[model samples]
Target: MTRRTENLAGRALMAAFCLAVLVPFAGIVLAALHPPGSVVPGLSWPQHPTLESFTRAWSDAGFGGLLRNSAVIALGVVPLALVCASLAGYAFATMTFRGRKVLFGFLMLGLALPYEAAVVPLYYDLRAIGLTDTPLALILALTGLFMPFGAFWMREQFLALPKEMTEAASIDGAGSWTVLWRVLLPCSRPALITLGLLYFLWAWNQFLLSLILIQNPAGRTAPAGLGFFVGAHNIDVPLLSAATLIVIGPVVAVYLFFQRHFIAGMLAGAVKG
Candidate 1:
């Protein structure tokens, strides 16, 4: 077959795959707008569209409070995670210290540890400390949970930088913190933003953690809020669909806004020699 034919076939396959993934979501959107008690026909638009479901779902599920809590937790976790990860990663990548390799190896173990394994222990620990059912618990847990990957990502970014940059800064009397904050960090914007966005997404969508850690429904994140919504509206497909869409809207908006930078950041380390 000619190259043109092969390219067309590949394109067709990709389009089909995308459609397959999107078709159900499209149905959900239509179903959300469908009249109460009406059956949603497969792959068809709503016959009697109404805005009531969105409003009803939003108020009844307490999404406003959920969104607020999720945002606060994400905002709390992302910066702390990024800063700690970046600093630790820089040290691991550049500095020689006693037990550095061992410490880093321990952090790396976090990457392989399942959240389920840690949740029970974390719950009891936090409860003992009187932090369970609080936003702080989620923030701290997520930051710790994210540390392994975050540190590794930043370490890769730091390692990719030329050694001469650090040498030059040192020769000019720049200290370690200054070199990191003023010089290296400015150049690491893409990687930093990518890391921060990833952390934000993880913290926002965190379900099991939010569900198990916070007993107060008001402190739950969107995904966790949707869990309650699911139980309350189990048989009401339209309401359930509306709640699901509401929960996903913020994540979708965030991706759309930072798509270009996100793409670049993801590919930044791919070509390193």
Candidate 2:
């Protein structure tokens, strides 16, 4: 097709794609505010909207504790994952040693082994280590679970760097660690931020691991706590919806603020790979 025709088609396709993605979120927002009886009565716009549901979801449902737990888990997971990914990525990209391919292949395998398979082993391991029902346990598990993808993605970014840059730094008598921190990382901001954001979203949404590891309500993350909010005794649909939206609010805000950065980083990493 001609360039103009291709451009027109692409724009049309993207507009449709945007509508497809946004319509569901709009529905959720509407439902969050609609009257209590309206969820199944029929879809309609919210009128005489009130945030009482949001307030109750925040306070009465004990969502505050869950929110705090999620924040702590994410805070801990992000830093630890960044450290592990950075080191592993630099090693895979720049350092050459025996069994390097074999080791990296093992790491790649982690990406495929679904965590459900490991939950039993992890539970036993946590029990053995006396970490069950603890925020630390959740943080540790999340860090380990995400490491493989984080390292793999970061390795692509590091490898895409021109070797000439590192070589020049070395010629100036800089050590490998120094060169990596000072020269390579400054150029890889997009990759680091992209990975951080992805890791945050994953840790935030993880319910299975949290559900299995955290039996205590105080330690439960937001998603699992939402499950508790909808119970046989009381199913407050509007409040639940409001709480769910609040749980996802931060990630959505981050995406909106960094949409361009996110797209650029993801495309650059993919193209380089």
Candidate 3:
């Protein structure tokens, strides 16, 4: 095809994809703007759109507590996961040790394992340890569950760096920790930011683990709380839509805030690979 033809085709394809995503989202927004308990059929615009559904949903769903719980879990998971992933990635990428390959291979097995298959066993195990029904249980589980991918991503990023950077740091009398914290980390900001965003998003949106592990309504994550809210308000489309938007608001805000770095990190990884 000619260059102009290819450009036009690509633009058209992009627009199609954008509409595919935005159309459903726009429908939800419109539905939410209708009065609470109103039947919003097929994305019809409300004649008198109001934010009443949002307020009612927030109060009815106890979203303040739900969002707080989600934040707490996400905050707990992100730092712990990042620390473990970075350390493991650094060791795997830059160090030589026995059983390294075996260890990495074993860790990678987690990527292939279905988390659902382990949920029942995990519940029993955590119950035995008196950790079930607590935020800590979910936090720890999410951190561990995220480790395999986190480590793999960090390892690729570290491996793509020039060996001379580490060598120079070593010659400058920098220890492993110093080289990691001071030298390498500064260069890996995009990767770290991207990974942290992913961790936060996953932790915030983790419904199954939150639902299964945390029984206390007071400690339920936003997504888990939303599930209950959905069940209770199944017939209220506007209120349900409003509640759904509230649950996902933080994730959308975070992505928008870090859009540049996330895109850069993804592009960097793609080029390196």
Candidate 4:
């Protein structure tokens, strides 16, 4: 086959893959729109579709408080993670220092270790410090947990930059901090935004950490709160579906808004790193 034919075939396959993924989600939307307590076949559009299920789910599930708590955690995590990760990543990628490789190896070890494996020890440690059940605990724990990936991502972005750029900036009397903030970071927008959005989604949807770390129901994230909501309303499909959408809406919206940047960042990181 010609190269043109092969390219067309690849595009067709990708379209089919996207359709396969979206069909199930479309069904969930339809399920949420169906009348409460009514059985609807898979992917069937409801004759009397209404958004009443959304309202009911939002109010009944205490999603207002849950959402607030999630927002707090995400807001705390994203900026802190971004700043720390970018700095660390830039150091690892650009600077030569004693024990740099050893330190980076330790950071990479975090990527290998499952967060679940350390949860028990973390619990006891936090309990000892009297940090249990506080938003601070969640923020600190998640920031640590997300550090490995965030640092690695920013490191890759920095590595992809031309060495001459930094050299020229230095010759022009710009310090490392000035070069990073004024020169490199402005150009690293795609990677930065991608990292921030990923952190937001992970922090928002965090279930086990939210469930175990926060003793108060109001401090739980949406996914963790949805676990409790499911226990009581699992049989109510419409309500469950609506709650799922509510829990996922912000993540989906953020992804849609940054779709192009996210794709570009991922591809750039993969190719250049």
Candidate 5:
């Protein structure tokens, strides 16, 4: 095929994919706009669109508390995971240590372990320590769960940097900490931002961990809270859709805000790899 024909075909394919995703989302939005207690048939537009469902769902679901808990867990997990990942990545990439390969392989095993398989034992373990039903439980669990991917991501990023950067910093009286903080981190901003965003997204959307660990209704994350909300109002499509939008709003906002950086980081990794 000619280049122009290939370009048109690709554009048409992309448009189709976009429509596939957007149509359902549009249906949800339209459903949420219908008057409360009224049945929405498929993707039809409401004659009287109202924000009442959004307000009602917000109040009923206690989204304020749920979102706050999610934020707290995400805030806690992101920093702890980032620090550990960065340190581990640096050590694995730049420093020599005994059992390094063995340890890394062991750590990578976490990537293979399904979250569903581990969550049951993890809940029991946390309950044994009386940490269940607390924000700290989710925070710690998510941090540990995220480490393998975070470490691997940062390791690849650090490895992609020229060795001379570290050597040059060392010759200038820079220690390991200094080299990492001053020289490497400045250059790895894209990768770090990308990894942090991923951590935030995972921590925010974490339902199973929050549900299994946090028995207290007040301490549940947004997604976990949404699950119960769904149970209570399964037939209320408008209310459920509004709550769903609320739960996903922050994630969408964060991604839109950092969209450029996220894309850049992915492209950088692709080129490096």
Candidate 6:
């Protein structure tokens, strides 16, 4: 195909995919604006839209507390996961020690083991330690579950760095830790930002682990509280829609800001590996 043909095809494909993704979000936005008793309603470019539901969901649902809990968990999880993963990843990539291969292999296996599989055991463990129903407990679980993916990806990123820089640093008598912190890490900013975003989104939206580890409604993340928004036999569709949009809005904004880097980060050096 010609260059123009390839470019045209790519633009069309991306436009189609963008529309596919946005349609549902458009539906939610419209639904949130629609009155409680509207009929034949399904996102028809509302003639009369309002923020009435969003304001009510926040005011009535005690969304303030839920937002606080979610924020605390996300804050703790992101830094903890990043620091731990960077340390482990740097060790795997730059250090030559006994059993390093075996240890790194085990870390990779964490990615395969479904986290839901061990929720029961985790509950017992946390309960034994008296950490259940606490934000700390949820943070620990998010960090433990999320650290592995970051470690594996970061190790690959560090390994893919120019060896000559490390050699140069070592020739100048810099230690391994110094070389990692001052040299390679400074150069891996994109990978770090990308990984941080992933951790934040996952930890922010995490429900299953939060449900098992945190028993209190106040301790639960916003996504989990959506379940309690309605009775068993009745549904509060507008409030639920508003809550859904609120919970997701921050993460969506984060993605929109870093979207240019997302595709590049995801596909970075994939074919070579």
- Candidate 2 — which residues are off by over 4 angstroms? 37-41, 232-236
Candidates 5 and 6 compared by TM-score, better number = 5
Score candidate 1 by TM-score against the native: 0.94
Candidate models: Cα lDDT each: 0.89, 0.85, 0.93, 0.90, 0.93, 0.82
- Cα RMSD, each candidate: 1.7, 1.8, 1.0, 1.4, 1.1, 2.1
* Model 3 TM-score (2 dp): 0.97
TM-score of each: 0.94, 0.93, 0.97, 0.95, 0.97, 0.92
Residue-wise C-alpha lDDT for candidate 4, range 75-185, written one tens digit per residue: 999999999899999999889999999999899899998899988888899999999899999999999999999888888898898989999999999998998999899
1-273 per-residue lDDT for model 2 (tens digits): 999999999999999999998887776677678655444233567667767667767886687778888888988899999989999999999999999999999999999988899998999999898999998999999999998998898888988988899999999999989988999988888888888888888999998999999999878898888877776215656766787898898778877887887888888787876
Clashing pairs in 5: none
For residues 1-273, what per-residue lDDT tens digits would candidate 6 score against the true structure? 999999999999999999999998888887777654344266676677777778877776677888788888999998899999899899888888999999888988888999889899999999999999999888898889987898888898998888999999999999978998999888777788889889989988888888788888778787766556544213556666777788888789888899877656666647323
Q: Please report the TM-score between candidate 2 and the true structure.
A: 0.93
Model 4 earns a TM-score of 0.95
What are the per-residue Cα lDDT tens digits for candidate 1 across 78-195? Answer: 9999999998889999899999999999999988878799899999999999999899999999999999999899898999988899899999999999999988888789899999
Q: Following a full C-alpha superposition, what root-mean-square deviation does model 1 have from the true structure?
A: 1.7
- What tens-digit string does per-residue lDDT give for candidate 5 at 1-273? 999999999999999999999999999999999977889989899999999999999999999999999999999999999999999999999998899999999999989989799998999999999999998898899989998999999999999999999999999999999999999889999999999999999999988889899989889899999999999999999999999999999999999999999999999999986
User: Which is the better candidate, 1 or 5, if ranked by TM-score?
Assistant: 5
Clashes of 1: 0
Task: Estimate, for each residue in 121-223, the C-alpha lDDT of model 3 and write its tens digit.
Answer: 9999999999987889998999999999999999999999888999999999999999999987788889999999999999999999888998988889999
Worst lDDT run of 10 residues, candidate 2, spans: 34-43
